[model samples]
Target: MTDIHQDPGAATRQEPGATSRRVIQEFWRLRWVAVAVALVGSFVYWPIIDNFRVSLTHQDIFTGETSPAGLENYRRLTEDPVIGLALWNNLAYAVISVLFQVFGAFLLAAIIEGLGSPRARAFWRAVYFIPSAISTTVTGLLFYFIYQPGMGLMDGVLQGLGLGAWSRVWLGDPDTAIYAIIAMSQWQGFGYAALLFSVAIQKIPAELYDAARMDGAGALRQIWSITLPMTREMTGLMVIITVTGAFQVFNEVMVMTGGGPNNASQVLGTWLYEQGFNQNDMGYAAAIGSLIFAVTMACGLAQLWLNARRRVT
Candidate 1:
């Protein structure tokens, strides 16, 4: 019988070599991603985690002291009447922004893109986009002046049209303050959204529109059948962004009214600022921030899930 002898050293040596190869392969695969992972952890994830930690503790900014507060800050958020008002304002802001910035902008973009002349299309696109290119602070200040009681442009136009009685102190009154800010927001922001929708519309193949036209489809019919469906992804993305922006609105409100007229225009962002910097309630501010984070995170996750569902379906 032939003697079979196992080389134990050979087996051991081969095993080590195989394991080393796997280790090297893993390191090579992750080499490029390591820096991105580290940066994201350091900047985004770490700040979020630290914010949550801060939300659970009360801090005296002047004295540089912090103490555990548990869920007290969150509980306080529930009891605060301003919080409820701010949430309602934010919801209104979201609803109005979606209507104008997302859907309205889509329609405007379709119309602009459908223009017979390329120069006309380009001119109109530039005109609409000018407001968005302007700084938000500058727009806010401009609108602030326009909303002035008697001297503003709105009042002048109303007076010119014999509708002077309709004009009021747009930014000073509690009943009209938030809506005024919302209007300014729509004016400044719809242009940007329309620009985005215009790009999306441009990506649609001309052949699709030609096919629709050959089937006796008019402009509106073609838009409904071809454009809307083609731009659904952009519409969905715009809705998410608009809603997030509505909730996070601060600049216009701060510049125009500072959440004034009895805090009537206070959104969560302004309210958080009011609590943190103005009132020196850092813990409560962090809690408010947490709520904002929760809302924006939900919006982002919902969009992701919708996209995934669409892909699966």
Candidate 2:
């Protein structure tokens, strides 16, 4: 016997099998939603994978045909001087940019964390992070114009300060162009780094700092020996993120220099773009893409390995 409320069909009782059948019917009606999603993915997902397969093969520029050429494209990537330059330049960029980003962001984040009040902390955080919100395209354009030779903003400002000799064509000069790109990347990247550090710092209990102070450690020593050590994992993570971004540098280069000034700022991303689109060397570009993917995975694995080593000790 069942309660009246539980017996939907009831003068007295309703069968559990009948209730289960209704539930199953409802589930069947809703199951179309899942099927539709799967059907949509079925149409698009296979083609994306097939295109990746085709990109690994040679493509005919004139006839628009493709054929498998195995690993020859990868061999060519090693032999090509331009590709070599691009790879070297990109590697350098990753090392230099990550160094700057980690040091600069960590310094700034630490200072912000030390501020006496919560509101002041937030205000400065916003001030520093505002530059990162703008599109890389717009930031590149703005800097490009600023660095434009005689009448540009940077030039004019330097000239007004009676330092006209100091103002050269910033983007046009080979020596200065990659540095200019780094400046832009740093501006965009520091915010995210700061945010990560800030979150980590906030999570660190204030009692830890207080205890360090009680042990006769001055603020500087406390930060150097305590705060920095405590936050090492976060630092490692931020370095990895910054390094990845440096290798993936593209938007600013595309908008500003297009790997110009004689490949002075040429990076792997733009090189890949040129290989796939301009040169129509899709297979080789796929090799480059694969190389980048492998390197990125390696960095992540390396970070994990170091973290595990730290935990073991």
Candidate 3:
């Protein structure tokens, strides 16, 4: 009773209709999910578009006047000395953060991994990670007191060691302010990176290390050959995290310095806050936000591409 020969064209026409019907049914079934996704996407991305629009306009926060300024704000950003200093400070912070938070964590993880007893390993891991568990705001406040001019712990320690000449107001001096902040950040953040590295290192097969040891490789040689190679991916990930965190650094800078001591330690986040809220330069602040978003996205994408390429090879 097949009517194939009777009307072959009829089946072809029905096939397209059937396919379209199925697609419509499927979309209807998942309509709520699609709606939720659209809602979330709009909620997340609308602000970004609005921020860009504001950046292109000269919107007075006080008088509520709005005018198109085109690229004037961006041009002013280029000429702004404070912006340049903030950029440089961000770069320095990234470098120092990578050196201490990422690499330092790797070293600590390696040492902990080499411990003979599981109890000792667990103890040290907890000890190192405890600092990271403390609230960052609390850590900043604690360090603020620790860096206080005369009666702080650092000054006391330096004086006790007969190094009084080296202990002059760590946070007060422009030369040492940023570095002191960097050190505090490292102390709080490195342990987290170390814990992650420790987990990655533990996953690496013990047989690899055992094989190296049988070849008369000492601890240093084993680490160089075995440990480092195994944790390469983790190191890459940590570097990306540290760099992004460095660029977006705000809490510590806000709590400790407020970009003070003549704005010597101004970073993009604090600078954005200063311009946007403090100075009522919302349009310019939006521009700075756009720049920070662009740069962070670019760096993240570049890192992901490089990591993927490295994996492919």
| Backbone N/Cα/C clashes per model | 0, 0, 0
lDDT of 1 by residue, 1-313 (tens): 9999988877557654788899999999998999999999999999888989999999888898999999999999889999999999999999999999999999999999999999999999999999998888999989988988899999999999999989988998889999999999899999999999999999999999998888889999988988998888888889889989888989888988899989999999999999999999898999999999999889878987886666411
User: Lowest-lDDT window of 10 residues in candidate 2?
Assistant: 3-12
How much is 241 displaced in model 1, in angstroms?
A: 0.8
lDDT of 2 at 23: 90
Where is model 1 more than 4 Å wrong at Cα? 1-20, 310-313
Instruction: Give per-residue lDDT, candidate 3, residue 160.
Output: 95
**Worst window of 10 by summed lDDT in candidate 1:** 304-313
TM-score of each: 0.92, 0.80, 0.90
Which TM-score value belongs to model 3? 0.90
Model 2 root-mean-square deviation: 7.8
Model 3: lDDT equals 0.88
Sorted on lDDT, best first, the list reads 1, 3, 2
TM-score of 1: 0.92
* Residue 167 error, candidate 1, Å: 1.9
Q: Give the per-residue lDDT digits (tens) of candidate 2, residues 282-301.
A: 77877777767667778878
lDDT per model, in order? 0.92, 0.79, 0.88
Candidate 3 residues 87-111, lDDT tens each? 8888899999999888889999999
Highest TM-score, which number?
1
